[model samples]
Target: MDDVAGIFARESPYLERYVQLGIASGRVLSVSFPDAPDEDAEVDHELLDRIFDYLSGVEDDFSDVEIALTVPTDQRRALDRVREIPYGDQINVETLARMTSGIDHTDEDDLNTVRTALDQNPAPLLIPDHRVRDGPSAAPPAIEQKLRSLEGL
Candidate 1:
């Protein structure tokens, strides 16, 4: 665990752990809660401030934060719906499936599709995968729950 403990670690005074972010081409590619703080993120200074604001419990408009995702149309649709979820509000997997696929009721296939999309999400917080209850995300489950608790409308 010591060797690769901080592949995605970012130093923050607000918390004991790290909040690492990956950025490229004016878009955040990834965010992760690694076990420790290691390398410093090198990206836009503005985005760094925004991330710090978020870490400090400020409900900044993450909707405007740019993110990159190269996925199929269906996955993009699911991620788009995830972005629309209210800051503090949470939706169920079944509901997300319905919202994305427009099925009368949610089935395993629809739910799985949504799950796959969420799991494949390159950008979690910007896309707000934590806003979806039981939704899969690249962020750790603990971090997802913590984000849900911290963010408010």
Candidate 2:
């Protein structure tokens, strides 16, 4: 399990996204989008099975899992705020920025700052960065829409 982490992917005519999970010491260490595998992810079959099972339902939330955010100091607070967003709920970037303002002194306007932090989020599904949006900041727009649709948002 140390050498091999589970990789899970889902696709539909309207949406496609890949989720890679690296676990160490029972905690999720790293999560990112890797190039799609050419073949099935059969190396870590059991882990991928569980992840796929959880993803099958729209209401399933990963908040119970411990996720690490190894991001820049300036972006850490904003990312944390994103994690607090309850499942099935979405918030505007302006609101997220205002909530994270106390983290550091910066120009009062935090829309750009918050958007930048979220744009660079490494763990999209785990952190639910798609919930933080004003207009089209959500990457791979179709996937974001699909995630929201799944959550019934």
Candidate 3:
């Protein structure tokens, strides 16, 4: 099983990208996003346990699946907030490195720092990007041909 475990915040967006790439490559088996509530708020152990129970339900399907977590660079406060939680300990640098690798055209120094941090602490943090990419259009001629055919019909 190539599954990765990380905080929900860090893993969500990267999961989206990984799923997209998996769909493109036809290698994705399944994806998991374990829910984590705000830690600074009052703790509801029962609710948290229930969430874990739900995650356990799907654990079998992803027996051999690769797990990835999304870590946001902007949520330092959130990371600090969850430091006491059990899953919080699982947050590490490898997950962050994987997430960083997904980012397009990042500076080498920044990437290296993130890698080094992962090496040192081995925790994942979430980094969200509001920027959008305007990727190239797919199947342009096919789309045009379909439009022309409809007009002719």
- The alpha-carbon deviation from the true structure for residue 141 of candidate 2, after best TM-score superposition, in angstroms, is 1.8
C-alpha-based local distance difference test score of model 3: 0.27
lDDT tens digits, residue span 1-153, model 3: 134222222222312211111111222222222344333322222222332343333111122222222345522322222232232123333334334434322455554554433322212211111000121112133322332232231
Candidate 3 stretches greater than 4 Å from native: 1-44, 58-104, 116-153
Q: Model 2, 1-153: lDDT tens per residue?
A: 434444434333334556555664555665554446425543354444545654566354566666556777657788788888887788887677667846433565455567677887766777788776563433466667776776777
Model 1 accuracy (lDDT, Cα): 0.70
Per-candidate TM-scores read 0.78, 0.69, 0.20
TM-score-superior candidate, 1 or 3: 1
Better of 1 and 3 by lDDT: 1
Q: Which should have the higher lDDT, number 2 or number 3?
A: 2
lDDT of 3 at 80: 29
Error of 2 at 100 (Å): 1.6
Q: Could you arrange the candidates by lDDT from highest to lowest?
A: 1, 2, 3
Off by over 4 Å in 1: 1-9, 13-15, 36-40, 101-105
Off by over 4 Å in 2: 1-17, 23-35, 38-54, 101-109, 135-139
31 in model 1: Cα distance from truth in Å?
1.8
